[model samples]
Target chain A: MFSGLSAFPLTPMQHGVVDEVAFIRLIERLADAGVDSIGALGSTGNYAYLTREERARIAQLAEKHAGDIPVIIGISALSTRDVLALAEDAQKAGASAVLLAPMSYQPLSEEEVFGLYETVAHNLSVPLCVYDNPRTTHFEFSDELHGHIAQLPNVGSIKIPGVPAAPDAASVRIERLRTLIPSHITIGISGDPLAAIGMNAGCEAWYSVIGGLFPQTALAITRASQAGDTQQALRLSERLNPLWALFSQHGGSLRVIATAAELQGLAASPCLPLPLQGLDKKGRQNLARVLDELSLT
Target chain B: MFSGLSAFPLTPMQHGVVDEVAFIRLIERLADAGVDSIGALGSTGNYAYLTREERARIAQLAEKHAGDIPVIIGISALSTRDVLALAEDAQKAGASAVLLAPMSYQPLSEEEVFGLYETVAHNLSVPLCVYDNPRTTHFEFSDELHGHIAQLPNVGSIKIPGVPAAPDAASVRIERLRTLIPSHITIGISGDPLAAIGMNAGCEAWYSVIGGLFPQTALAITRASQAGDTQQALRLSERLNPLWALFSQHGGSLRVIATAAELQGLAASPCLPLPLQGLDKKGRQNLARVLDELSLT
Candidate 1:
């Protein structure tokens, strides 16, 4: 079973080129901090901006650095054919599993949703995880659709965002999901800075974008949660709350990942692809204040 | 100088491959019907569903069949790099111009929007048109952003959708748009079945998705509009109105184009890439009734 903290590594770029060395270092750093798994080419990783070759290269690097740790490669594309192609590449590159956010724009029917997962599962040699980040995808997978996808051979997990409710309500949803699928199908929660809240609510895994920048802080929270120390996990979450708030602004995940990499002296520039602008003056000031409070600088 | 009707032909697919013969035939048919110009791989043509090679082949086929008619290739992709590559291919395929949509899913800032068009203009050898279809793109190009893009070299036209208001209001927006840019930059309006409404409102061109399926009807409307016979144009539009309604249901443009191609016997099946299911029994029945009413079957 996949449990504990998982880090979605931010893809590094310099002068419009993928920074392989920086990426390797970032993966290694997360692995050293006891991150249970690594996610590459996710929303936080700017998967839309990377070429197919670049994506494969990053997946290979992630696998090499992760060692025994599982690597969940994000296969988010606007077209199903491209998603299947990416899934095949990720599996060949040694990824442990593939996570998919089907069709970023346009609402899809239940049949379409089922077809998407079925195609990916058929094309991929490894297990598949469903990514239900509705905020970006614009289409939510209904409970009925989820149950149908769960019956597929390779679908083993669901990555749900932690927003829209508290742990108790989230726990209820997880229970509902559990009843629909087999016990082997894990429920993973994303979007909560306080990883313990999700873990306590019966989530088998937690994926964090902030974890890439602050591995030790994230690990501490995860360890506290695993040990059933609710107070300690909450305390860590409170301490890191300001940083999370800063990163949750305009294109927050992208900005946070880039800023954090810069703080670590890894990426040469905090450049995001077109349509996602970098931090403005006020944003930079806010980030500075957060960094100072965290003693990260 | 662009006026009257424009046609965006379907990229024919046969046996899971791009059917270049059918695609060329479709374009030639449109050109013979006196279409002012031809647009390939727009939303009406399922632009996102195609591979790079497939898209390139379709563009080349359009140019080949277009002969003396201007062929404007659609360069729509999630990444700036991919879109630029498409623009370069379009130029090589003998396209007279290219149209670009903004980044998919990720909302861009005004500055980022300008940057995208600026990059395209600087690198692209052919004249570039900015396509503003907020319905599909999910983000509207601000008047300010449009102004900045128009100032860039080689930026030639603006393609605005006809919905959310009537032709008069759209014409007013274009008039205001013209003040901020060079007079050489023409404004084209898409989404109206009748060509006269947009043409009378000062738009230089009218792009019709329905035209590919009904070239004779589209030609009649175009000829009537160009000759200043508004009554005849309106009559033809009324006949075409029911067909437009059939095409506008459930996933709209993509479904419409696919269905139209199938109706014309251009392709054996209407295939949609993953996450977009084929039309249901009710949809097919509705389309059949409309086609029968219009004597298009």
Candidate 2:
């Protein structure tokens, strides 16, 4: 359940409210596409912007709609009490596992972060994934800290923030991390653009953003890499360079993916929550062209 | 209301709920201390850890108990929708002004951030304080963005993180920022240890954490700096060197300030939101000694 491609679907919002219909459709799509797991309410899902009830409902929806595939629900919050509550909600919703990022408002200390995992991990009935997405959480996990956290109860994986661009360098980075963590704890890679490279370099899982919206494309890259066809994986990834470019130009994948979803009629137009404008007309037009060229939409 | 010493009181919590009684007492103390303004729900107040209902009630409590003093309520959130809601609540609760930090879970672009302030600023009935607190918000505001946001309606101040250590450098830093915005938008300085230096260097206000708890100590420094008695201001700040040392050693001011408040009986013993441990036994002992040595208790 921790390995292979884990697709993350956006919890689409319309007029500042969670669009439940669009969200369930996204789940069924990922489940139908044969993703090994579905990562619900990740950064791409705009989980941070959601209230507890919203997150709980999204977790239940994802768990129910993902069919036989395992679901990993993101349970990150600014406070431990809240994270624990979310984790409980996820477990009760039948989530196979939960993801936690050390989301901070007051910049957290190393001790506080460790304590957060320790407290939550002990209480959790399901497996836990440490989400090390520094871009959003602004909390960098040192390899030493990862090693410590991985040893805690229920910690099944560490979703590292991608590796070096070069294949050999990426392999070396993954191998170094593998040594620190226990064998049972799967090492997954995030950063959509680097998914193919990271999986080819021995990261057991590709926790993907693009996979949520474009599962077949993401699956092709994942399967090729898993089969040791590094060249095929790289080639497929290179084909999606236009999509990656869009992700870069638009400040990460949420807006671009939501834009793609909106354009594809997968979700409502203007799906993003407030304070987060999806894209301007020009960027959306550019995305439309790129999606057309790639045959993604 | 945007200038001089703005004392930021902790919205003290007890067993995961807002300690309204303790919170009210803290506000009344600040009012009695004769602070120029009360900055409720600031980082020191653990505003991000609270619910909208809790924050609204706190804002109302602060406004009502603060007597004639102006109360600046912090209304920052992950989404603009929530921010707008909180802003409306503050206005309804009779807030003199509102403080906003570009809080994020998705790492935002400069354009997105500017759009946030632009959207929130225009909707605000009360004047807005641009909370440039990179340490907490993890979103650094460039001077150009500050200048741009300052031009928006209701933007009355920019609460900068801090200035350079040296007197000459601090003045240069503040002066450069001064040129970026209109004179009506006062430049307030945070980073409690540097309050004296930044205020003396030309900051119109000290958005102080320590001021919330120990009003007399903070006010003396603020008054001296405003009176051009830089030597006296610096001397008073230097006397609190032990306190500053604790802040540096403990990551930042929130934890240390919370610990101080807990020891002083200003709030509950474990005042802060969970996942944020105030201090360990040894650390608290050290804090107690420093508080006693400084005659702060």
Candidate 3:
């Protein structure tokens, strides 16, 4: 299953269609940086915004450009049937595994949530990673529910979203989760700001959004933290703090990261799907200054 | 353009597919009971759980069986492009208006929310209704934002969800909204339990879920309330309190209403999309007892 630093790339778009060439370039950069895995269509990738056909195309492009790196396609949907459908499509598209999130229109009971993962995992030939991001899904999974899902067949990993404001709390949460879940189930931490703390707390991987844009920086933090070099890891994370601060202020990093990519000329104008505005002038200026300070420009 | 009681039908499902036959029967019942309009693919319709193709097909069914009753199609999507696409399909299917909700994976700012309606309303030939349901969309529109949306060229109405426990508060909210928005832009109240109060408080229409299942009863309440027959309206609503209590307890009436339809032998089963469980045994027993007491079965 997905391990180490997994780059969750932004699905670059042109006129509401996925720009495959730009997407390929993004993936190649991650592969070139020696990132361990690629997660296409993750939340940062705007999985819910894209159409079904566009999603399939983006997964295919990510897989093709990933080379030897494993590609984990995000297969979150409102229904179990749609999740299963996307999982099958991901497997057929050569994805190494599929990430499942409990995205619901209605509030789901604990039993229903478990049924969603168990039913989808039962039908999939590829390994299934439970994506526990309550911020996006609005359905919180208790430690007891997480333990139940981990014991299910074909469930291989869990992508834990760290609490950005409290890195120490994230470390404590991951530590608690590690003890509760099966030993074989890999624990990967997301939330760019807290990745270092999660790694130091014994998370096996970093399922990262910014890594897709700055894989070198993300990889450096993981390598340093994993080698027990806490000082070096702290220094690297401190350098990234300016951008992380903007992410926190905006309540999300999608638009800020997209703006960062555009400002650095890595991609075209930072245009997201309509109704979702990209960074304003103030946000762009703030992001540009941070990128310059980090020597990333 | 829609006024009076508007029936919001449940998109009856057989396995994973929308059961068209059952859907038509549901609409025909509303038309026969003299409902003023029809809103298909609403929240009760499980619009998010359905595919684009299924949604389009359901709109066509609703229009066909609705006869001359104005059909307002629910056109909510995460992306503006998808919302526009669905809106166009709805227009082609002979819809009178389209309902738009600020449905996003990420929480949208007031600017983004306004832009969603402005962009969609720009291209639509029919009227557009702002569907402000924070519980489902998680994107709340302040009174200022609602006024902004109301001023859009093609925006004709706003569907306000009632505060179930406080019908007086729901009525006062509608009265405030009515004064803020254009006189021509009608304010309709949803939340079936409070429909009677909304009607009495001068709301132009009832965008109802239970009305789709029990149209005759819903119409009677509307007619009584609209004629300034407060006592009659209160008596009618009192008769339906048992069912309304269950709806309130569930936080939503979709599953309960679906169960009521099944209990009355309208649909085959009370199936929601996977991951959203149907009523448990206790809920079912409570619902059955209510239906029996109401003489609905």
Candidate 4:
């Protein structure tokens, strides 16, 4: 169930409030595109910026709108108690699996992180995905630590940051993790730009940012990678190089993705939470030009 | 208003609830020790682990027990809206100033961070202290960014990490910031181990961790430095070298600080929020030995 393409949607916010209508529409769009799983409240979803009430409602909305697509809800928070509470909410809202990132304010120690997963994993009814997103959560997981966490009960998958760019190096990286992680636990790849390489490198799934907006585009890469068509996957990924460049230039993907969603009329203007003005005029202009060139506009 | 020795007390918690009595006792200890200010909800205070309601009550308790000493509340949150709300609560609770760190799950851009300070600073009735805690917050601030933020009104101080180990280097480091920041805006140094060095290096204040619990000891260093007795200040810092080394070995100051407070019978055992174990048995033994040698226990 964890294998294949998992799309992370932006939980569109309008004027500091979750745009429930737009949010449901995003879920439906991903469902219509036949994505394997819908990752709601992932980093791109602005889950950390939201309150529990809003998050719980969003979880329900995702479940209601996702049709048969499995819903993986992000339950990351600073405190373990809060993470537990959010996990419970996600489970109640019919999440197929829950995603947990070591989202922190005080940079966490390894023991604390393991304890968090152990305690949360012990209590979970649904399987848990260890979200090793150093870019946002700022917690780097050692391979040994991931091995330890993967042994916890209800641990079903690990969503890792992108693999090495080179094909041989990417295979070696995943192979090392594979030796430690259990076979039941699927390894999914994030870092939208490198999704094709990671998937082609034997990742069971692509946990993508662009997949949330342009599922068809992301699927083209995912399906090719899955079919052992390495050339097609690489070719498709190269086409979106401009978008990936924008993501890097902007520091991260949330802002860039927000702009793309807004441009596509899928979300409101200034859809992101406060203090995160989506993209400046210059960035937007560049994005529009690139999207037009790629025929993704 | 943001000068001398500002003691940041822990908001002691018991079984996941704020230990009001113990928290108040810590506040009284700082106030009785004649600290220049009481910095409630600082990192040592575990501001990030707390809920908004927990934070608001902590702020009120801090103000109530602090007597005439000005109270500085840490109002940091992931969302700007929440930070603004927390700032309002702090002000309503009679805080002299509010401290904000760009604590993030999505690693923030420079503009997002500046906008956070700008928006929060504009709304604040009290002064705002820019909290540059890269160790905990994981957001690095450039000197140019500091210069840009310093121009915003109500930005009364910047709680910098620490200065260089060498006297000459420390002086140059603080002096460089002095040129960019407004003269009126105080440059306070944190990192408890280096507090004395920073103070002697011309830092206007010591935003201390140890001072939160051992106000008298920290003040001895602060007083010597304020008197321009660099030799005595350095000597005092050198004496506590064991404790500083423990903090480094243990990853950060909070857990070590929590252990010391617990040993002193000042806070409940395991006072830190869950997932942040105060210290393991081995770590505790090491800390206890160091505290005993320092005659702090």
What DockQ does candidate 1 have relative to the true complex?
0.57
Model 4 Cα lDDT, one tens digit per residue, A131-232: 999888778999999999999999999999989999999999999999999999999999988888899899998888999988998888889989899999
Measured against the true two-chain complex, the DockQ scores of the candidates, in the order shown, are: 0.57, 0.76, 0.81, 0.79
- Residue A246 lDDT, candidate 3, scale 0-100: 93
Candidate 3 deviant stretches above 4 angstroms: A163-171, B163-171
Q: What would the C-alpha RMSD of candidate 1 be, to one decimal place?
A: 2.5
**CAPRI rating of model 3:** high
Best-performing candidate as measured by TM-score: 4
Please give the CA lDDT of all the candidate structures.
0.75, 0.92, 0.85, 0.91
Per-residue error at B236 for model 3, in Å?
1.8
Q: What DockQ would candidate 2 receive versus the native complex?
A: 0.76
TM-score of chain B of 4: 0.98
lDDT of 1 by residue, B29-142 (tens): 887777778888887676777878888988888888887889889988877778888988889999998888884665666777777888888998888888988767766887
**How far in Å is the alpha carbon of A271 misplaced in model 2?**
1.9
Query: Can you rank all candidates by DockQ, best first?
Result: 3, 4, 2, 1
User: RMSD of model 3, in Å?
Assistant: 1.6
Best to worst by TM-score, what's the order?
Answer: 4, 3, 2, 1
